[model samples]
Target: METTLRKSDEHESISDGNELRHGSVVIAAITSCTNTSNPSVMIGAALLARNALEKGLKVKSFVKTSFAPGSRVVIDYLKDAGLMDYLEELGFHLVGYGCTTCIGNSGPLKNEFINDIQDKDLVVASVLSGNRNFEGRINPHTRVNYLASPPLVVAFALAGTVSINMEKEPLGTDLEGNLVFLRDVWPNSKEITKLIDKFVSTKLYTKEYSEIFKGWDLWNELKPPKEDVYQWEENSTYIREPPFFKDFPMEKPPTTDIKGARVIALLGGSVTTDHISPAGTIPLDMPAGRYLISKGIDIDNFNSFGSRRGNDEVMMRGTFGNIRIKNLLTNREGGWTSYHPTKEIMPIYDAAIKYIDSNTPLIVIAGNDYGMGSSRDWAAKGTQLLGIKAVIAESFERIHRSNLVGMGVLPLQFKEGESATSLGLTGEETFDIYGIREIEPLSELDVTARGINEEELKFKVIARLDTPIDIEYYQNGGILHTVLRNMIKK
Candidate 1:
């Protein structure tokens, strides 16, 4: 970690722990299938935006807001409600349809805005109605990104920044500098229900989606294979099958002695799967993008990393920490690390690449509730692609832990009050776990942390394999591979 790495001007997670300021809103989006799929929340946002517009409220000019629904029909209903104009007027214009801000396809933060933020060290925050508000998932510059409802996203755009809590203070001021409180503009459940009942017709779901199912031109353009096993392309960037899935030997127990195994990285608490697998702009200069370009893929035509899920190369290189991940080992503020076999700090992604180069396996150690938010399969798949054989954490997010098992990456949990930090574990120590064959639900396994002091520290971590099915999935490589194999047998 560079001593000169300046702390961010405004460092606030979703929890409001400090003051916020008014300024640039780099990415103000109402996205994610999780929330948008529910018509009630969508209609509520629309109604609130409409109410704000009726009160002569306006979105700040600098806010780069957009509506990127997981499915396209969200737009149709918004139009049907006659609220598209209200959202558009507030800069919530329609961007591309699938996961946008949440997955780091935040497009571009404008040049002037970027300059303002970088120069002024502006206190900017993105209020998005999406799941996952991890550090760098949105635009890279905005520091205080908050996760809220769609209405709150619109409210923040109107207010300009997360300066004041919408729940407490007035959202804005009038020409007379009169305060406009959130409750004053907020639509009650009854009012929203009326609009939803009147505007959101069932025909939109039934008729519109039926036509969509037949095919939209965008979906039709994607050339998915009819064959069960994807044809592994030697040079394609969008859809190459991963090595983990190809002829993986399931019966082989943990090879390379868990007791003697080297520690690749040490992580902290609340280390979401986003830290494990970043879903963002694939920098053309990064190793992943370079690999894509080497495969004859044009840089301009290179879509986001989120869109290239089937490709193991792109996902593998994109794994571990957004450019913004802070490795506690090196005290570095951004990017993943490559730990030396002896535990020295190097570039994160570069470290994994080094381990691969040296034929060494990798593991991630973290605190409680690891891998929260979203049912994104890539969260697990990306980690597996990155060569992480197992994830030992304090606790696991329900979906992501399952996702890890689905990807054949073993998931382990530490006993109470035990974590990477408390155990004096750093990124440099090689970790070894034994009795994997005896792992079961709430089963205990011996974990040994070998440090430079040449001392071995051993403890027990809970094996999260709660089900026979989970054990089967781990044995098969991953959930998808297991399913594919089962389908073949059937």
Candidate 2:
């Protein structure tokens, strides 16, 4: 994680002996709607860049820098204020006008840097003007991520590391060899407000919005099918018609007891949707990556899971696939699980497929506050597609619980003061849940766990179908099913 700079004739401004220490800011992005939409912060960042340029400071070449504003209007205002040049000089070139690094679409790191990072096992960092800094949500190589204001993101790029104390440490030196601290370049409130008032206007917004629907030439050139039912491309890896209704039955099937269900994953607390379904770069070695490769796609063209979300084949393989997820069933980290039938350690998707092939139902056992982050619908959809019939946890995030119910995957809450750990449930038991056929809102249901030695542990769980509408959704096999059936009847 350290690099030594050698003075070259092409770029003699860089000092020959300068060294970039550990904790290098590999990715410094001014992206995400949370900050980019606010003119105050955006102006503040540009002003700071202007000041930094005046002092003859420059961003380290090793750091990857990008600026992706939430709206196109932001670029107009920055140009109006004549501050875009300064930002560009400092390496904050415009990448796009929407979510970039924030959603893990920051793209790949340099090959040399990647090799050095892996060889040294160095822990690099990223500073972004984004709201989400979840574990493994940023670049996979970036072990540490910090959420900062837009200006701070630029400052870190100049400083080349997050390990420095902005209050006291010098970001770099000027041409006169004078040490420059962050305070010297920080923008004042009056300056920010003045720029905002002078450059940002309602007229500019209206002008930009008028052409919003008239997409660029490339978008306008493409033709869509006029058929009543949309045709699916079998060879396309990006979009495919989902299989949610492929096996739909006109008549609702009677709810039966879940018997002999196996555990797909035994997760711990605060398991976010990010862990259940990552939106970042698709690793070339994982199941999703293999699927894409099988389709003749190169490693470079394997887009993010979020980009390929329309294809259930990719998303299903990505479920529980976060590189940092810890499945208690396996001794190692990541998306690994132990298939009960073969007792083989394999990817969670592989195990789920095996269970599905055997016509066996699967359940997930977890600790408290399960599914607590970013109410991602794919978290529930992937679970249902993987044949997970129920998710039994000590607690559930409200939106994710609702999503599970909407997807017809039962959300069962453990009784008070009881959990997988407290009850000594090792997730190695065949589970049976009764009373699902007679389920009602907030109803208590009986559960039995049979161990390998024929010992049975019994417990009662509260079904998370909290409303009459939730019951209707579950009975029809999902919210989509209910809507489709109702439309057909009409």
Candidate 3:
């Protein structure tokens, strides 16, 4: 069988033989617990790698291949089976121990590939054994991602491109010019089961678990303060005391009607928590990246947003910072919004800062199923820090709606059969929600939209405070505030 190639018309070939013109598999990672915990799949991946190596199949030089097992026991079993060498030969070298590529820690591609992908605007892909393949949750450059078993991850890395059918098309040619197919190297169920039964044991588990509580040399070297109240470092970029409890009063604050609220983002349907609070790589030009740079951190050392999440400064700036997010306020994609005061298009964080500085209350308008992806608490925390007083959408994802309430950010739903488009919300109108002070669980409230020309558009929205506890949380200005007040009383 001859290797199939999807020819490119507009863009020139980046590969040596014009092989990867369709879409390159830039990242192939076997990370996270989804498949690694299962010995069958783990050994199966190793067996496939050994078979591919015997046939002289090589992963493309461009593919960034890594193997991050969920447990050290996975390593012990593979080493015991003597299949680790084959995996390493095929570029599946061990990178880390846990949650690497799946959580968007795939890291940077080669500088050469990065330049080409950006310059040509080529679509790339990542095939990971880990479960998560959310948009912008993988590599920023890899637009397309596929969740596959560990063996398939290696196969795609060898194939070098996703634009092929593994069923029919050959992955690559062998050293003897013989065509190689997926079926040829795929490990049988019996072989996977036999390996699992042979090498996986309680002894391996016991050894790994015995040393789990023992700290590494680096961890042991840390000298933590003995003070009950943490001594916050003034210049630490990794961790900082969050401002959530700053100036917190013992008495619960009165809930006020939201007036003169500007829309931070007018998003479409299925707007995920990943879009709201990305855990991926920090772009050099983004606000979070700029903040890191200003703190004297080099671009290479500016770790992922997830790594720096303990620092509220970085996390807050990272809110709505997904590289793929489309804020309808601007006529472009990415984490950008129209700063209504100056009619200037800017990064969402910058606009948020300006809004916060001017004491302008912020609200996000979205379509149905808003905040639907991961139940990231930072999605709500970042919103609160950005001074977002409310989020009005056609509907909300259940957990995210609860998170918003827990953060004291009002979650309001548009009336049934009504949407932002139907209501003619240009995302340019000043919004006001009346009857918040006298709110009840699941209460209907009046929303007034004042246009630039002072035209009033009136509608009703449902306050999504679902219970008495939720109402109490809101009235006290968030769950944390409620807890602090109760502690003070006690």
Candidate 4:
């Protein structure tokens, strides 16, 4: 995590070898749909916080603590059991009704705190009970993201760093100037289980969920643009008419060999959909921001990439636009990368535009666990828009690989004990992936990488078209395109 975040981006960042700088806990959130749905953990966290406050333990002043329960029932049960007051006293307050800290919806860190993190090169930590702890998926500056349980999040908030072995070291000094360790306030499992068993009932869930559809007053009251088919607004920045179906004929594209494919971005392991299908803040200087400005949208009105996903122009430009994304082709981080042949440093979107203009097919070469984060379709969709015909990686995450096929992007796996690094790929090599004419589920295919000096290295990759249906999706250009064709046939 430290290695990735330290790279230079839009804002100046810490360089390597300063990994052990000042450590602090900037955000400690017990927020997510996962743990909050489990009553034992939510009640357990409140109980733990209650015990800690009684013992004069306080969370670090800098730690931004929030409790975003999964639903209203979780809140009701905690309040009914008299645990909300205890939880609030120890700094965990209800911030939002839905995903708050997780999904990078975590609101701003204080300017002073932000300055401290940047100026001091402090390696701050965020202890989130939320599922994803992928680099840059949480707050960008919070480098060390720990996926802990709700109770542990509260504990880390009080302790203030992952540096300490809480069992061995003191979290902080209590009122009497005595060092306090975790055991001093830690609630045992038996008590937590007993409290959960006594308080949580099926009646609470039944009653809360019974009116789920009817009670969304805001949604029910919303008047959509009354039309059977959505009227695509050309001037709207949020959405546009999808071009995939509009510009092309209703015919399956031929499965031709991908030759002279340029490597757009060379990535290491664990590149999340968040990196590709960006969600949070759009900087005024980035590609998406510039495009929005051209559309008469101010920087402040740029919103987030997530809110504007319906716009292919913005979504395509926002691909690899994440401020924290690391494109290994350049020594620096950010959404910028060196456009091959030109060696000119430009935003990823600009280079992709250039490549598309020149009719160059693009491909991403990556290490293990490529596309590992959220199961977002736009991740694959964005790749296809960028002209990426194939992805040759050491391995792939299951759903993402399927999404790639759904977008008609070929997914390939490196033969065991082989990787881009192992094969000495520097992201400059022109790759030719052939022998996919009769592509099958898990069939072996050839990938030949040729250097500028004309030196060649060849390897085999397994086609990750998991099923025959997946192959059909690929042949028809995409899953949606295939479905449209099937409907026409019927």
Q: Pick the candidate with the highest TM-score.
A: 3
Per lDDT, the best of the predicted structures is: 3
TM-score-based ranking: 3, 2, 4, 1
Question: lDDT scores for all predictions?
Answer: 0.73, 0.88, 0.89, 0.82
* Worst-scoring 10-residue span by lDDT in model 3: 1-10
| Per-residue C-alpha lDDT of model 2 across residues 1-490, encoded as one tens digit per residue | 1223223323533322134335678889999976798999999999999999999998887788999988899999999999999899988899898878988988898988888778876667899999898778889888888898999998888888766667766889998999999999999999899999999999889999999999999999999899999899988899998899897898777888899999989999999988887589887888899999999999888989889999999999989998888999999878899999889999899999989999999999998888987889899999999999999999999999999989999999999999999888999999999999999999999999999897999999999999999999999888999899999999
* Model 2 worst lDDT run, 10 consecutive residues: 1-10
| Pairs with backbone N, CA or C atoms under 3 Å apart (clashes), candidate 3 | 276-320
Model 4: CA > 4 A from native:
1-21, 188-198, 296-302, 322-324, 438-448, 454-461
- Please, what are the lDDT tens digits per residue for candidate 4 over residues 266-374? 9988887777777666667888888999989977577777778899998888788776789999987778888998899999889988999999999988888888878
Candidate 1 wrong stretches, greater than 4 Å: 1-24, 34-56, 69-83, 96-98, 165-198, 217-233, 247-256, 296-300, 341-345, 437-443, 467-490
**Cα error of candidate 3 at position 207, Å:** 1.0
- Name the candidate, 2 or 4, with the larger lDDT value: 2
Each prediction's RMSD to truth: 5.7, 5.1, 2.3, 4.8
Residue pairs in clash, model 1: 258-432, 262-430, 263-430, 336-348, 337-348, 338-347, 338-348, 338-351, 343-428, 406-479
In order of appearance, the predictions have TM-scores of 0.80, 0.94, 0.96, 0.88
Which residue pairs in model 4 clash with each other?
none
Model 3 ranges with Cα > 4 A deviation: 1-18
